[model samples]
Each structure stands twice: as structure tokens, then as C-alpha cells.
Target: MKKIAVILSGSGVFDGAEIHESVLALHAVEKAGATWHCFAPNVEQLHVVNHLTGEATEESRNVLVEAARIARGIIEDVAKLNVDDFDALLVPGGFGAAKNLTDFAINGAECSINADVAAACRAFKDAKKPAGYLCIAPVIIPMVYPESVKGTIGNDDGTAAGFNGLGGQHVDCPVDDIVFDEENNVLSTPAYMLANSISGAASGIEKLVTKLVALA
Candidate 1:
């Protein structure tokens, strides 16, 4: 069986991982008959957010701890993810992805990915393994690829511009469509960036997972 590594940001849509996207990604993994191992960076979140109020809060949270909420307590520190244990990697979108996995939300194209996250993603890149990224998670595509890699984020101008700065070719995509960077073995979709419902997000996500597993 193919072992797919799932990297989650947090547990919520406001402060961490988008619940729908995260769950859907996992479903796609299972549907493909591939086992998935969850991983998260063991670090403090940039800050906490009250999802209901959409405001910053005073509580400090660990990225891995919060991510475990979504993984149902079965997850590992991304720093310890062994390349040999997984055939592919997948990242779901949420504010936490930009905030915790990489600082693209605050720093734009100049953002730096968390060291452990970078290492995990780079391991797949170095091994020529395929990866699937959804929503803002695709912002880190360039960081893992030396050449200009092609990806999409539902055509958000500012984000696309930032992707360009990071040495990536941003293609405008819709919620139901995906961008396949064949040479790099990378797949991405706009997902919630353009979806009005969970099913819409799943359309592209399912395709991405299918393609990624096939590549693996």
C-alpha cells in the first residue's frame, strides 16, 4: 500500500486548518486505498484566533497539539517525518497553513517556511515524489522547487504576484479545476479559495489525490 503523508496546519478554519479541506483530503487519501500518516510542525502558532469573532486572541497554542485535534490524536512531528515512510505528501489549506507552515500570510513572497515543514516537503522534492497542495498551501511550492514551478490559488492577484516573487508561475484556476506541474510532480487546486461549498472543494481535491497517488 502507498503511504501518503498528510501535513496539517491546525484544527480550525480561522486560526488553523480548514476543517472541511483537511477532512476531505484525508478522505481522498483513503479512497485511493493509500494509508495516510499525519504530521505537524511542533511549534507555537503565530497567534490564536477566535473563529467566531474572526479576531486575534491571547491564548498561545502549539501547532502540533492543535493539529492533533483534526488528526484524532494520531499524528507525528513533521520534523521526524522519514522520506522513506511515505510515497507522497499532501497539504490542506487554512489560515494556519499560511501562518504556521509558512509565513506567506504576513511576509508575502518573502515569507519563510518553518524549518521542519521545509525539511519535510524538501524530502519529497529531493526524492522526486509527488505532492498535492490545496488553497494557500500552494504558496510554498516555489520554496520546494528551485525552478519556476507552476501552481494556482484561484487567481487572487496579490497572492499570485507573491508567487511570482517566489519564482513560481501562478495559473488562474477555478474551484473545480487543478493545475498539474507534471515535470515537478506537483498538483494543486484552488479549493476554498473559490469554493462556495465543501463538495466544490472536493472536486479538485479528489482529482489531485488521484493524480498524486498515480504519480507515486
Candidate 2:
């Protein structure tokens, strides 16, 4: 069985909606007959602030603390394992992963810009092991390959502007629709949306895992 790593942001909500993308992706991976591992950063607990108001409130703090605890636990478990044990790395999208100061977001950035994560990703690529990402998780690609020959993919508005600071073309299909280049160097998909449904998310995951296994 191919071993895979799935990364999730600890935050449960993003843009007023709960992030069920990662959970659904997990289910799909299992169905694909791959061994799955979960990773979340255990960054320092932070107080949640309203993106619109920028106000600090008790409710926000509590919520963030809880998220951090969960993210930390996941990361701790993954970090203990040898990366060589896994055939590929999978990153599932959620608000927590996209938001800064959290595990998913922080680690995603690291994997994108940091030399270590980049090296690891490159190694995985060289091995022909399939790496999977859904929803906003594709953001890591641009971060890692800012000026590569590969094109971007996601929920962008055609002009490549999507999410808070990310840019890519808006895809009409489910997040499981994997877009890639001839070299298989670039993989893109849409997993999360502003007005998303749980059923859609679940369906997307099933497609994503199936596509990934086929690609592998």
C-alpha cells in the first residue's frame, strides 16, 4: 500500500463556514487503498480576531485556543514519523490551513517557500509518487513555484484572483477534478467554496482519491 500524508488546518471554520474539505478527503484516500497520515501544525495558541472588525474578544480567543490544540496534536503525530515511509503528501484545504498563525497555514507556507519542504516535495515528485491537494491547498503550488511554467488552478475568478490573497482560474467542476501538465509536475483542483455543501465536498473527495491513485 502507498503511504500518504494528509495535512489539515486546525481551524474548523473559514469565511463563516466550517471546513469539511480535509475530512472528506480523508475518506476518499481510505477508499483508494492508501495508508493515510494526518498532520497539523502545533503553533502557539493565538487569539482569534475578527477579519472585518479586527476586534479581540473572549469568544474568539477560546475558539482559537481550541483550534491550536487540535492542530498541534495532529502535527506532533506526523512529525514523529519518517517522511520516507510515505509515498506522497496530501494537503486538504480548510480555513485553518489558509489562515496565518495556524498549523495548516504555517506549514503550507513552509512547504511552499521553505527549502526543506520544497526539497521534500521535489523528492516526492522525482519518485513519481503522487501528491494530492484540494481546495485552497493548491495555493502551496504558487508559493513553491511562483514563476514556474505551470499554470494555476482553483476557485479563482478566471483572472486568477481567488481566496483572500491567492490567484487562479475559477473551476466549475468539483474539487476532485485534477488539472495537471504533461510532465505531471503541476496538479490543481478546487475543494472548497464560499457556498459549499457537505455532500459536494464528500463527492469531490472520492473523485480526488481515485484520480490520485490512478495518477500514481
Candidate 3:
């Protein structure tokens, strides 16, 4: 059986991982006949947000602890992720991917990735293992891959420019499609970046997961 490593930012769409995207990706992985293990950085979130009100709150939270909520408490620290044990990697997105995973939400193209997160991702790249990145999570792709590595995040102009500025070639993909960098063994989908509904997001996610497992 193929084993996949899934990295999460947190449990919510406002400040963490997109609940729908994360769950959909996980389900797709299993449906593809692959198993998944979740991981998160052991660090504090950039800030907390009240999803209902769409407002920032003064509450403090740990990335791993909050991400566990999505993983059902069956996750490990990203620092402990050994690429040799897994066939592929998958990172679902939300604001947390930009805010927490790489600070792309705040710093855009100038953002730096968390050391542990960078290490794990680079491990997969170095080993030539296939990896799938969803939604805003593609912001981390250029940092992990070589110059001009291809990816997508729907068709947001500002976000697309940032991706290009970061040395990645951003492809304008549709909600139900994906862009695969065959040479780099990387794949990306718009997911919630373009989808207005869960079913819309599922179409691309399912395809990406199935392709990721097949490549693995």
C-alpha cells in the first residue's frame, strides 16, 4: 500500500487549514487506496480568528494542537516526518497555509517557510517523490522546488504575481482541474481557491490525490 504524508496548518479556514479541503483530500487519499499520516509544525499560529465573525481574536493557539483537531488527534510533529517512510506528500490549504506554513499571507513572495516544514518538503523533493499541494498551499512550491517550478492557485492576479515573483511559474487552472510539474514531480490544484462549493473542490482534489498515489 502507498503511504502519504499530509501536512496541516490548523483546523479552520480563517486561521488554519480549510476543513473541507483537508477532509476532502484525506478521503480522496483513502479512496485512491492509499493511507495517510498527518503532521504539523510545532509552533504558535500567527493569530487566531473567529470564523463566524471573520474577525481576529486575542487568543493564542499552537499549530500542532489545533491541527490535531483536523487529524482527529492522530498527527505527529512535522519535524519528525521521515520522507523515506512515505511515498508521497499532500498539503491542503487555507489561510493557515499562507499565514502559518510559510507566512505568504503576510509577506507574499518574500515569505520564508518554517524550518521543519521546509525540511520535510525538501526531503520529498530531494527523493523525487511526488507531492500534491492544494489551494494557497502552492505558495510553498517554489521554495521547495527549483526555479520556475509550475503550480496554480486559481486565477487571482495578486496571488499569481506573488507566485511568479517567488520564482514559480503560476498556471491559471480551473476549479475542477490541476497543474502538474511533471519534471519536478509536483502537482497543484485550485481547490477552494476557485471552488464555491464542496463538490466543486472535490473534483480537482480527487483527481490530484489519485494522480499523486499513482505517481508514488
**C-alpha TM-scores of all predictions:** 0.98, 0.67, 0.99
The alpha-carbon deviation from the true structure for residue 71 of candidate 2, after best TM-score superposition, in angstroms, is: 9.1
lDDT tens per residue, model 1, 7-95: 99988887788899999999998999898989999999999998888899999999999999999998999988999998999999998
TM-score of 2: 0.67
Residue-level lDDT tens digits of model 3 in 1-216: 999999999989989999999999999999999999999999999999999999999999999999999999989999999999999999999999999999999988999999999999999999999999999999999999999999999999999999999999999999999999999999999999999999999999999999999999
Task: For each candidate in the order shown, give its overall lDDT on alpha carbons.
Answer: 0.92, 0.52, 0.97
Candidate 3 local distance difference test against the native? 0.97
Q: Which candidate's TM-score is highest?
A: 3
Query: What RMSD does model 2 have?
Result: 5.6
1 or 3: which has the higher TM-score? Answer: 3
Model 2, span 38-157: residue lDDT tens: 654434324454655756446533333343343344443333435677876776665544553223344432333323334545555666676766666565555543344243334456
Question: Which residue ranges in model 1 land beyond 4 Å of their true spot?
Answer: none
**lDDT accuracy of residue 177 in candidate 1:** 88
Collision pairs in model 2 = 42-72, 135-191, 156-170, 160-168, 175-190
Candidate number of the best lDDT: 3
Which should have the higher lDDT, number 1 or number 3? 3
Q: List the residue pairs that clash in candidate 3.
A: none
